[model samples]
Target: MATSRALAQAPPAPARRGQHPGIALTVIAATQLMVVLDITIVNIALPHIQQALNFNTTDLSWVINAYTLTFGGLLLLGGRTGDILGRRRVFIAGVLVFALASLLAGVAQSSAWLLAARSLQGLGGAIASPTALALIATNFREGPERNRAFGVFSAVAGAGGAIGLLLGGMLTSWLSWRWVFFVNVPIGIAIALLAPLYINESERHPGRFDLVGAFTATVGMVSLVFGFIRAAEHGWTDSVTLLSFSLAVVLLAAFVLNERRAPQPITPLHLLRDRNRSGAYGLMLCVAAAMFSIFFFVTLFVQDILGFSPLRAGFAFLPISVAIIAAAQFAARNQVRYGPKPFLVTGSLLVLGGVVWAAQTGITTTYVGGVLGPTLLFGLGMGSIFVPVMLTAVSHVAPHETGAATGMLNTTQQVGGSLGLSILVTVYGTASRNEARQQLGAFLHQATPQQLVEFRATGRLPAPYSSQVLVHGISSAFQMGLVFAALAVLIAVFVIKVRPAPAPVSPSGEGA
Candidate 1:
């Protein structure tokens, strides 16, 4: 019950005169859009990047994973760095790093070069994003104005990925895949230039650095993700896959033990002590994981199977962004009145229904018949969860631990995405390979000399046959998404508890 009260309302932050609050909010939203969009901007570019870099099917996922892994891994460290140094300084410096990384990624000459640049870009994002949130308090007074600011920020952050898909399409279609990275360069520079002028610097909060905990936790999760991806390409029994899993287990166990004793753990174990908060975390992880299916696999399907051009495929996703923005605003207004359970349950059901519909995607399915309904449902469901779950995470957090708590919320969301993607990708790879094998048997019946030679060299069927294999894999991946949505619903209904906000007191001090 006490945990539920933190969402009651934040006290008004000290009002500072002379700062351009509007400009500050723009800079914040722009910076977040840059950071979050990078996670999915590459979605539409994957086919292009894969062809240009000569990446195998499994390795192609790394372009996205490389960025997210480091971004999620280093978030707490980045948040604390802002606390120790000045937020404005850290924020500006982060923007510079991000800009430079984007430039590097844009001009990458090799797969290795691109992946490295992507990881650096993630580092820059980690440094910038959480500190950007802290800067909001520096720029705006807490109350209705601040809540409105957050609502705007959330709309930008939540819809950023869908925006990226559209943006990536235009860039990849007209100029080059490189433009996706280059687009961020200008945005990052503009934000860096504006942040100092418009945003005030928060006073340095002295804090102990849990570098060891952050390192272990980050590396351990990477290993777990690596193992999943590895097993997808190689068999689960493969030596490298076995080694990766073993290493992950040992390192993650070490991370937990280190956190238990660390002076100030990057992720305070006590934060998970509350059922409401923990349930939010658990549900967020599952929902984030399931959400990836729409962007990654479905993006592939529309382009590779449905014959949608990159630009058209991008615009196809525009409705999802609209649905989420609308639903999220609606939920943000009503969550306190009805409590979180109704939204969480209803949203998860939408998500479940969406995934089930999407799993039926086949070579014969059209976008209108297959993609729109599922993506819209999934987007609306995601909107429902975004506000309530976030409010729940910070509800009972101690003021001193607030930074750590929010950092974990972002970290969980990011890492959960990568982890979930790795799992779905594994399923995708397995099912695609099996489908490929099945197609090979039939293909020999009609194999021309050129087709036979190509099949021998690349081990892939052409055209319609290839599309069949891809659709099968995507269908299987969405089937896995079903489990994620189900878990989210179960967690919300059974585990999370939020009593509606206590009645506001009147002028005489009695409940209104």
Candidate 2:
């Protein structure tokens, strides 16, 4: 109780003035961009990495899953660390660790070495991302200035995946795929050096670290994520997958019990007690689930199915990035006036429409008709959703709880992406197998015995037949994406209910 009172009374660091403020904002934004995009940057490089490391198809997913699982799992602890220690100290430590991990990842020789490095990178990201957002709340006054700052941050957050696709493709094409990891070294180093000069450290709360709570929560999330990943590759009934799920449930239950009793909990359960904030978190989860699927399946569609070069595939996402930036900026300017509900509802509907339209893609569909249109719609919808949802997630929260709130928001996104992708992959696999079986049956009926013998020997489908089956699988995944988007829409309409923020008063004591 003493610690909680002290935390509530702790003052935010004064905002820096003039040119130094811009530099500080730049440092924060740059760190955020690096952390967020790392989630997807390695995606484009996966094939190259697999070939170089002699990874079987099943093992290759660990490269992505390892990072996401640790990053998502540890975020709550990272947020509490920032609150208990100095935000600046933890932020710098995270950047340094990230840079070192990136260096190790770039030079890794074996699959295990790379996975280890990637897990460290996720740890670094988990520490850095929540603290970075909390810094914005600490540094900026809560009004237009903060809204504009969040606009830039939100835009980067929304567009980072698309940007990663482009950046990864360029790096993988011009240089080696290793450059994708190596590229972070220079950026992380610069952020670490510049942050101290520009960014102010927040007041640290006096408390004990919730080590037990942290352990259970992190392990629980990891198990749950692993279970989903395993289910995607193996059948849901596989013993290992079932065991992972069972362990996850047990560990997570223990984590909840621990948090309930811990004097200083990693996750402050009270944060979720507010209806609007909880709704915001839920909406982000659903939106992220849909958004991640869009990126994953679209990347696969453009690259594997369309035979796009790495550079071309990266450029393919440029439109979506641009649209997100523009939409986020617009939301930044107007959300205070109109409130978040309209934007949330409309944005979610756009996402649903875009994903449903994307489900119409076929083997013969053109990029302009099939991919580009849906991409634009998704971009617009996502941009609108990101800014408003971010605002609601932190709305009306006490000053001390800012880091935890933002951390929870980010955790939902990372976990949702991992979970959504796993589910979609499962859907895709089942759909593909069924489609292939049907196609094989039709082919067997048409073919002569000698033709059947040749076909069986080759074990391959000719040309468009194989492409058609794959596209069908991708489309089925998009249909699942529609379900996610629709859930977000329902949450927005039914769950979220926040009043508009009051206009800021000027120095003259009148509303601006």
Which predicted model would earn the best TM-score?
2
Misplaced by over 4 Å in model 1 are: 1-20, 50-59, 137-143, 445-458, 506-512
Worst 10 residues of 2 by lDDT: 8-17
Compute the lDDT for candidate 2.
Answer: 0.87
Query: Among these predicted structures, which one has the highest lDDT?
Result: 2
lDDT of 2 by residue, 402-494 (tens): 888999999999888888888888889878888888777777777778876877899976555678789989999999988899999999999
Model 2 spans with C-alpha error above 4 angstroms: 1-19, 446-458, 507-509
Would you list the C-alpha lDDT of every candidate in the order shown?
0.83, 0.87
- Over the stretch 404-423, how does candidate 1's per-residue lDDT look in tens digits? 66677788889888999889
Q: Cα deviation in Å at residue 9, candidate 2?
A: 15
**Clash pairs (backbone) in predicted model 2:** none
